[model samples]
Target: MQINQLTRVYRYDGIDLPIPPHLADDPQGLRAYHATLYPAILNAETVDAGVIGTTHVTEYRRAVGTKG
Candidate 1:
C-alpha cells in the first residue's frame, strides 16, 4: 500500500479545491487552472481601465550581456 501526501489548495469565498500532485508540480497547469476557474473576475473590464500609465522604453540594454 502507498499513500501520497497532499499539497496545495485553492481557497476563495469559502471554496476549497484540492490540487492534484501532478497539477501542483506543473507551473503552466497551475496558471491555466486559475485562469479557467476565475475567467470572469480575472478578465474584468476594470483591470484594463486600471492601467493609466505608459512605460516608455528609451533604450534596449541587456544587463546580463556583459558578465563580470
Candidate 2:
C-alpha cells in the first residue's frame, strides 16, 4: 500500500496560508495562531476544502452580513 503524507493549508482572501510546522497537527492552535495574524479569522468559518494531491485544504471564509 502507498502512503500519502498529509499537509494543511488555510485559504484566506484568495491566498493560501501555510501553517507553521509546530502547529501542523494542531487545528485549534493554528486557528488561534492564525487569528493573531489575521483578525478576520476570528470570526471566519473553517471549512474543509478537501484534499488535493497529498495536501489537505481548509478555508477561512468570512461571514458576510450587515450589522442589525
Clashing pairs in 2: none
Off by over 4 Å in 2: none
lDDT of 2 by residue, 21-61 (tens): 99887989999998988899999999999999887889999
The TM-score between candidate 1 and the true structure equals 0.34
True-structure Cα RMSD, model 1: 17.7
List candidate 1 stretches off by more than 4 Å. 1-6, 40-68
Separately for all candidates shown, the number of backbone clashes (residues 3 or more apart, or on different chains) is 0, 0
Give the 10-residue window scoring lowest on summed lDDT in candidate 2: 7-16
Residue 17's C-alpha lDDT in candidate 2? 82
lDDT of each: 0.41, 0.88
Task: Judge candidate 1 against the unseen true structure and give its global Cα lDDT, from 0 to 1.
Answer: 0.41
